[model samples]
Target chain A: MTRSAVSHADLTTLSAHKVRAAIREGAYGGHTAGLAAGKLQCNLAILPERYALDFLRFCQRNPKPCPIVGVSDTGNPHLPTLGSNIDIRTDVSKYRVFRNGALSEEISDISQVWADDLVTVALGCSFTFENALLRHQIPVRHIEDGKNVPMFRTNIDLVPAGQFSGKMVVTMRPIPQAQVAQAKEISSRFPQAHGAPIATGDPAQIGIADLSRPDWGDGVQIREGEVPVYWACGVTPQNVLLDAGLPLCITHSPGHMLIADVAEDAETTILTTP
Target chain B: MTRSAVSHADLTTLSAHKVRAAIREGAYGGHTAGLAAGKLQCNLAILPERYALDFLRFCQRNPKPCPIVGVSDTGNPHLPTLGSNIDIRTDVSKYRVFRNGALSEEISDISQVWADDLVTVALGCSFTFENALLRHQIPVRHIEDGKNVPMFRTNIDLVPAGQFSGKMVVTMRPIPQAQVAQAKEISSRFPQAHGAPIATGDPAQIGIADLSRPDWGDGVQIREGEVPVYWACGVTPQNVLLDAGLPLCITHSPGHMLIADVAEDAETTILTTP
Candidate 1:
């Protein structure tokens, strides 16, 4: 099916499992931006079991950017805690293959690359809170502009664990000055989804020299009366792993995530608010 | 000073540092039961640096039992995050020395046993939440009975990390049927202090065959119209360390804790309700 044809369906009508199945069977291979509405979707990170402990520490130390939702048992592609019959190797519509820290391939299935020594980590994504924001009638600039949220590397250093160490990367959103407090209260409820803004107003306070240039994603225009708010981004782990020059790493490609059986609202209340 | 003289002089009036000073100077060695009222008191764990990372992982995996209040920089003995001027070796009123996982001595000061490779971990104690429970009018059976809270070993296996792994340990408190909900809500707010009860009624559900036979502390009577509630106990780490058969380890004797500068209320709000 064409990408445009796939995008036309009312996502509100389908369940998360059905959407994931479509993605798994090559019936769909596109950005999951607005698909599987009201379901928890996550950023995927699959690595060797040897590095799992340290990675878990890294996430614990830096919960804002790496709020872990579910960690698959070693070598098991199914995350029983996340959803029944959800296969990590095939659930995500697209996977970025990295070998020795370099981009090796982008494919629909990693069943060929799957190993008994591998471990999968599912991290909460900002999209969870973005839905919360929209629910509260807060306008998200990037989504309205039909572009990815702009992300930047900051001077803030992540708490290192073993071989994983790097600076924090954050995503930017523009909120009206009057609505900033509401934005914070709404977002803070989603701790699993990066929680509240790390910094607002002056980008330079967090070491960003230019708001126009972002390290990842397309930058959105910051209009008058709107203040730029920043949040810890999920892209952080992938970036850190790449920086560490690990021999192998696998992650879901940007905008293509693993949709879980967990209801978005249920997960939002459990993870974000708690 | 006599214990009677010290007990009457507003024992809860002093700061954590002053309280420790009195203990260190041999002026006070009685149970730290009502001292430093609102401060965060901790269960102490000291081990060689080689075991630090594994223990950290163990704590991470079993957060309910070992909610870390502070971890000293290796061999530093000073816990800066917990409090300024807090010296792990001297601040705790009493210390239990263990050699090859066996009890060696209970001393007032461990300055002589201090080592460059030792790492000190300050874990949250139930005292913080016990105060909350009492304030909310929930009867704490053990406290009213003038006994240590009954603790038991459960069939639930803790997530093992490295060499540390064992069954979970729990502390029991009997609450009136009507007050059980309030007790859970209040205690759940203090995740650092063992958080909410792990099991409410039948101890058998968590693998405890008898209510009278406790692994540690004094067992209290469960009266009519009351239910026994269990919270993960701080003694879990100590028990696990002993089971690991480490060459050396040290902990605060039961009821003798290291008082911290963090307010009890702050810790309560930080974990449960956050």
Candidate 2:
């Protein structure tokens, strides 16, 4: 399908599978913040099997920032449990190839680099909760601004496992003081999507120095009566994986993600079966 | 520290650290239910570092049956984050030692058998939720009768990883018809302690044949107007590890546990730091 065939505005009406097919066919290579509606979109982190368990533990240890949404079997690109016909190698619009913890290349497909020892881990993203917040009539400033959510690295140290360890990265959202509690209540139900806010009020408390200049994404203006709320961001795993100095790791670029078949609020405790 | 000096009734008021101390000193060699009220009591699984990652993955894949509360570093006997001075080798009242996936001995302490490559995993238990249920004025039949909770092996296929895989083991609790919703709400808050029920109303749905003859623990009578609710039990990891045929494995004997310093209702996410 051509870019004109599936217009940017019409992307929202398309099913997740169609969107993935477009991405696989190299038709779309843009952010997927609101494309899949109510479906769960996941941040991708594919690593060698040698590092898979340790990385899984890192997510388990720091679930606030790195909630495990779906994990594929080692060497298998198909996340069958998470989505029908989901191919981790080429489903995402764009991919970042990290070699020895450094960005080596940008690619649209990882089929050539896929190895039998590789494992794909899909972590729940803020988009899931953002949708829930929107459903509850809570304003999401980033979505409203049509910009990527501002993310910052904090002093909060992630519990390390093996070689995967680093400071947590958090996404900031400005919420009116009145809706902060309601926002938390709505988002807490989506624990697979980083759950509730990790910190509210001053970003300085969590070691974030400036609101104007973020480490990642675009900064949003905090209104007079609004407090800067922070939720653990999925970028955490990507940041840690880069720092982990692994020989090879592949992750979804910025807003590109693997759209899952799961409902945003599906019970995270029992999503898998073997 | 004589056993007679620390009466079972007096145990309830003791602090978790103190209770662990008494157990370490050989003063307490019995079940740990009601002893550490409000504090989290964890089911222990100690395995070699070789099997640690796969087991951790199994737990991650099957969180409902194996909610990870604490994981000790490789070869580390102390779980400093979970408690002030938790020595996995000697803390629990009783331990079941498995060799080649079969029970070889039941011992009070594992110091003699402890190895340098061993790792300790602490899984959240139903006792935490049971305490919450009782506090909410919900009846817990097992606690009422001073009997062990009924546990059954279900047909639920656990998400497998590496050499670890098995069916889930669930504990049954009969909730009154009117309070089932309330019971679910209260229990849902304790995700670290298996969260909400996996199945309710029927035993046959999950493939349990007989409620009276449970695979583990004592069977409780399902009274009139009460529906049988099943929560993923901690025994799942044990069952899986046994089936994995690992060279060495150790687990807390039924009813014995490692009392953690964390509050049962403490935030499940963001629990650890390096």
> Best-fitting candidate, measured by TM-score?
2
Q: What are the TM-scores, per candidate, against the unseen true structure? A: 0.75, 0.94
What lDDT would each prediction earn against the true structure? 0.81, 0.85
Clashing pairs in 2: none
Model 2, A1-274: lDDT tens digits are 6754455576888888899988888788777877878888999999998887678767777888888777777788988668888888889988999999899999989999999999888888988888888888888898899788999999988888888888989999999899999999888888788888988988789998899899989988888899888999999989999998899999999888888777777776233542
Residue B198, candidate 2: Cα error in Å is 1.9
List model 1 lDDT by residue over B27-85, tens digit each.
77777887888888889899997787668757755778888666665678876556767
Error of 2 at B63 (Å): 2.0
Residue pairs with backbone atoms closer than 3 Å in model 1 (clashes): A100-A247, A189-A272, A189-A273, A190-A272, A191-A272
| Model 1 quality (TM-score) | 0.75
lDDT of 2 by residue, B1-274 (tens): 5655465676788899889888888888888888878888999899998787778767777878888877777788987667776788989999999999899999999999999999888899998889889999999999899788899999988878789887989999999999999999899888889988988987899999999999988989999999999999998998888898889999999988888887787776233542
Q: Interface root mean square deviation of every model, in Å? A: 5.9, 2.4
Candidate with top DockQ is 2
